[model samples]
Target: MSELAEPTVDPADWTCPAPLRDQPVVVMGHGGGGALSAELIEQVFAPAYGNATLAALTDSAVLDLGGARLAFSTDSYVVRPLFFPGGGLGDLAVNGTVNDLAMSGARPAYLSAAFVLEEGVELAVVEKVARAMGAAAEAAGVVVATGDTKVVESGHGDGVYVTTSGVGLVPAGVDIRPQRARPGDVVIVSGPIGLHGVAVMSVREGLEFGVEIASDTAPLADLVAAMLAVTPDIHVLRDPTRGGLGASLNEIARASGTGVRLSERSIPVPDAVANACGFLGLDPLYVANEGRLVAFVPPSAAEEVLAAMRAHPQGSGAAVIGECVAEHPGMVVVATGLGGTRVVDLPLGEQLPRIC
Candidate 1:
């Protein structure tokens, strides 16, 4: 055989693939916890990190350290207006990370908060936020172990941005994750949805619905503990945060390769939220929630788990909204009140940005 010459390549010929290539720059959707967010992590961050733990893509990374299982998670809060109806940036920061750890069947124990403050921001504002953080940490039964502060030039940053990292211990025999969702599992939401997004929007836009909607920005570690008390075999747990219930269900379906079917009537949408969304031309399903969670439990244990959730204050509105199915794996379908079925795809981006 004749020898062949080596092929020549040009470095300038390279280009990023579709979606990301289309944008060519970071956009709000990249951080919206939607399809764009997933793509960014899968196409960019995941390959760069090249770790199996990160590949799992759970809300928190479960690590085995010194013969103990720990769940670690971090989140940043850049919510505008700083304060909202039931909570503010500080509590939101603490609760957000705590909830992420709790989703992995972990009992959150400690948190570290880092603050990025803008120059010329009032000292009283920082003090108020710090007090809120302290109170929220105490309420969640976690300590703010360590943190750092940095100041940015005026107008170069939001008044304040808080990033919180948390660690928690996962109990023995608990293995909660999205991939664990399976056909025949029952889906349940802890309570009414869309309040947090609407609450923030109402404040930001000064739009009033008939009744005031408060952000459901409470810690969910205790509620998760209560459900675990019922049974540790819970298949999956997700706190539908940035992308709301619709995005969360789609994520679970894709992760588990199972189809999720929801009942429109069964979903508990508060009247105030429904009215506000109607006025704003928004869907409640795509609105963000701070304290709510969606859980998948094996049918055999679903009733008891749901009962436990209901008995807890945070889950007083707990309802059976759906079930996982074998058909249409990796898709979510909802049965409408008018005898119709609609597919609920993962949102492309958040309807409300900087609300979390």
Candidate 2:
């Protein structure tokens, strides 16, 4: 090779990529759905005013209060455009917090909404968003028990941002947490991955794909109830929202001190999503999802839990994509269709911004 020739790249010798770690202040990646977000929590937030609940970092904090178990969570939505195919920010706000509670094997019961509005935004827009929230809560059979609103100067805020907090009851004999994942646990995903992120990007960025992809933003409380019916001993349930399946699984691996092995072919990626991600140099595994969940269950109850999941409307497309392993603890690996193995690491930064 001549001195002027370009260097060859080897995909096999992969390393987790990120910007230099010496950044003094904040960058977009700090809010991005990846390692930077986790770092912010671990390095800065967790160490201050911390408790065991935040340390676990599960979907929601399962608390034992007054002899009653409760799952509590909160989420804020700043999705650009406010509206997209299949849903809007209002619906996303309600469903996101509800799903977080549901992941803890709780039946979501009530939510509180708070809004931050820009000064120049129209009243009609706020009502439309509020109406959407009302309808979504009704559909999920949950209630918006309370709410508050405030306004910001036009330039200081998005048109509208919503924050929601929820509380739900956990049934007796039901315990679920990421740290409970074990070596023989079966890993299941509720449905196709990458739809919600792509749906938002396609509309917000005006990217053209042949077919329209809709966001998969729906509530999952009932679907969780179905799985609990099969066995109350289920180990882990995590919604693959920000940072997608890869980040969710990686978190579980680290929390449980176990390894995760996935089959490339078994992980479902819709053709449209795959093409869009490939063209954009994005990995669907690392994309965001609004309505999908990943579960870890003991081998003895894998089939029963899978069947229960598939029987629910929210889980009709559920599939077993991998298993918890004892090898390479704290890492995730995929066996490719071409007979090669590759490591899947928690993304160092967000691949797409404001995806959820």
Candidate 3:
């Protein structure tokens, strides 16, 4: 009989303490939704400001007045290459907020947008952004109930920055949160990754891939409806936008205090995106995807829900990439192609700053 191999070693034996590396500076990693991001929140934001509202960690604070639950989420868009292959800042600002609301298992119905335009920014350009916003709202089946616009000196702000706040209603008896993900749950990606980041980067850098690779920036209200229709037991829903799939998965694992095991071979990455990542020394898993979502569902319902997702246009490339586990709590590990395993920790720093 062959001898059994020794058990795998824990990462703590070698991993360094994250806080000691950076003492005072606020680096991009603090916003990357990985370990550093959590550190900043726990050390700076949560401690300096202690309140019941912020501690909930919900996408929106919930009020308990006669038992009606309302969801609110706000996001600021500062995407470079304001106009990219698949979308522009205007559409992104609207869709991004809508998706954030939907991720909370809420039906997005209202939005408030604020825009900061730089001086000398032509009126025609501003009008173009307004038109895009209207179209996006119509497509998502949401309304821009209120808005404000401001102009700043050219040197003070970027070309434009949009802050969008959204409100929605969560149906009774439905609960979805990152901390709710549990062992034996299945993980699903709505579609491919890296397309949006690569597309935006290519445009900003003037790199060509012989074919246009555009941002996958679209609202997820319809997709969410279909998903909840099939299985209302979804534990978590997140869009791996700014830090991509790697960061999102890491966050979920940490939040739920569970181990996540993913099969790298199962992830759906487009050919154009894979090529672009290779040429640019980037990992497709760490690239942003504006139009995709990650879902955590009961293992038994995974196949049925995956089929339903694949039937939708936004989730045509849907796949079951991983499952939650009990070991390695608060960490995520992936089975690489070469029969090796590595931790898919949150990125330590920004791979491409200001991409979004």
What are the lDDT figures for the candidates, one per model? 0.93, 0.90, 0.84
**lDDT of each residue in 89-154, candidate 2, tens digit only:** 988998999999999999999999999999999999999999999999999889999999999998
What is the TM-score (0 to 1) of candidate 1?
0.94
Q: Provide the TM-score for each candidate, comma-separated.
A: 0.94, 0.93, 0.90
* Window of ten residues with lowest summed lDDT in model 3: 12-21
> By lDDT, who's the top model here?
1
- Candidate 1 residue lDDT tens string, 1-356: 33685444353543432366455567778888898888998888899998778877789999999999999999999998899899999889999999999999999999999999999999999999999999999999999999999999998998999999999999999999999999999999999999999999999999999778899999999999999999999999999999999999999999999999999999999999999999999999999999999999999999999999999999999999999999999999999999999999999888898987
Top TM-score hit? 1
lDDT of 1 at 48: 99
For lDDT, candidate 1 versus 2, the one ahead is 1
Give the 10-residue window scoring lowest on summed lDDT in candidate 2. 11-20
Mind giving the per-residue lDDT tens digits that candidate 3 earns over 256-355? 9999999999999999999999999999989988889999999888888899899899888899999999999989899999999988877865577676
Question: Candidate 2 clashing pairs?
Answer: none
- Please identify model 2 stretches exceeding 4 Å from their true place: 1-21
